[model samples]
Target: MSATTLPIPTDAGDLPGLLWLPEDRDEPVPGLVVLQEIFGLSEYVQQRCADLAALGCAVLAPQLFARLDPPVAGIEDGDDVEAWLAEGMELTSRLPWERAEADAIAALGALRAHGAVDQERVGLLGFCYGGGLAVAAAASAEEEDRPPSALISYYGSALPTLLERAARVEVPSLHHFGTADAFIPSQTVEEIREAVTAGGTREQVRFELHEGAGHAFDNPHPALHHAAASEAAWRLTAGFLAETLFPRS
Candidate 1:
């Protein structure tokens, strides 16, 4: 299904967001706030949002890159992988982490307040840059006593710096990482696992390591996509959302 443009109210102003709703929406359903990778809300991200909606979710993805000078909603991947990566990284650098984090929380609030969403069942799902934002937002939301019901982060690129706040995020969470990720080494991933899981104390947390998969393995880019790992990660993510947000009655 095609997504409609939704305006998310934030402290700075209304952030543009893309929203997707299930075709058979008879009542309030679980909602998810999808954060974008450094590439912004690209086609791949939009497709993933649609996929979530197909599974009976009210999905909203905020345009984090809109805060830029020219306001880039998304960027197209180019032939030069390094150049494309550098461009994305530069865009993200322009948008301060604090602003992005607040925008993420605002998006969650907007999703919770949406008419089609079950506020209590709202969660957060993000990839790459957004994955890390999801963790930060989840923690901030929890601090404000508005925790999401669930969280699924795929190779959170900023996770290393956000580990300090892990204690505040007690909701059901699933984290996916690549063993061969050059951006985030295996050692750091293990550290992340330890912090999020609290040394195996948190039963509600789940961490998966995708063998041989590099960062952003789910992205369809020729240099990034790992078919086997992507399929497995999506399967796990779908199942996790099913159990946490849309449990069988």
Candidate 2:
């Protein structure tokens, strides 16, 4: 469980990122680029990265909020979610979506280039805002023949805006959403499902809906967390990543 700050070179500039490597690493392992939620790389995100490492992965999380004049890495659980949301929206408002998209791709490049990773087996896992960005990154990668091996998106807030591109996501992917998500209603979820699976390869793209869970239900914060749904989603994510990125050889 070694965590260190690493610089990731992107077209935009050098982006500060957190790198987590599993201990007792005697060999290269699959890698993952974890995109942050609206709150940035908060403790919950770091914990998620550590969880992935425990499952045998090298994880890199780019600090997207670094583009701000005074970088905002993450917010504490005690911080007001509404205030943080407002601040996050303002921060992203200042940054262009294209630049954010580029930074995400660069994150994949960084993971691929890292000596401890099996370049061919890197995946992208994004939550909330990042989930949408992940779709864009994965789409661009597929277009360039450097697509992620797998993608896991959890209630991507920008899914609607990125649907046109997300529909083009051609990798083994899994999407998790709460049927009761206020931000993205169930209706939109159905639309997303239709668009992404329009090509008739349903087996390759899967979507799971938790009956009454809300957005960010996996967050440990009591207000946003749904214990049962979170546990089920985690189990599904772990199995999905394993089956897609590290198939039995």
Candidate 3:
């Protein structure tokens, strides 16, 4: 129940993160990395870390932008958000997406190496930008090190683009998209579905379409949230997590 900020030990540097531990730590806990959206670790992202902790996992959400001024920040949402997101995307454009890929892998590594964490039982959950990070994380390594047992993405950005190189994402990946997404049209969604099926194994990949939600449907911001889509996505994400990462636990 108590959530606190902590440093995530990484070979690159000491990454800053928010740690949420269960009220009862009677046993070693499963590990999880809640990758941030482009907006960074905002209240919504932090709350999600808490939610995962309540599910019995030791969760850490790293401040990936710590090197920048204001180690922790929430991107201001407005007409400015588009520019901010674009600039943020540009910053990461040079950021060796592969390195971010490694960092997600290292997060799981650090958790496993923590001794307090059970390495065998690990998973990742991401949203928006992080959702894409989740898939890249899943696709980044061999089964031994970065074996992402489960994957969940909410209106993941750049998915269709990545589908062009879809073979890279061989792990169990699940996607949720809003039917009315201005960013991704119905035709594009259908194309993405085709790419999903063509890109990898059908049995391991699943897609869900929400009736009337746009991008970032899961977030609670009035300009973005869709009640029905958000609820449905959450239910499906939770179920996927339970089945893939903790099947026998």
Which numbered prediction scores highest in lDDT against the true structure?
Answer: 1
Task: Assess each prediction's global lDDT (C-alpha) against the native.
Answer: 0.94, 0.89, 0.73
**Residue 184 CA displacement from its true place in model 2, Å:** 0.5
* Global lDDT of model 1: 0.94
TM-score of each: 0.99, 0.96, 0.85
Candidate 2 stretches with Cα past 4 Å from truth are none
Checking candidate 2 for backbone clashes, the offending pairs are: none
- For 1-249, candidate 2 gives per-residue lDDT tens digits of 667988999876799999999786777899999999887899999999999999989999999988887878886675677776687677778778888889999999998999999998999999998998999999999999999999999998899877799988878999999988998988889888887776556679989998889999998888789998999999999999889887487
Q: Model 3, stretches more than 4 Å misplaced?
A: 69-72, 76-96, 143-145, 199-201, 247-249
Per-residue lDDT, model 3, residue 26, is 66
Please name the candidate that would achieve the greatest TM-score relative to the true structure: 1
lDDT of 3 by residue, 137-212 (tens): 7666544555765667777676766765544555566788898899777887788777766643477888898998
In model 1, where do residues sit more than 4 Å from their true spots?
A: none
Q: Which scores greater on lDDT, model 2 or model 3? A: 2
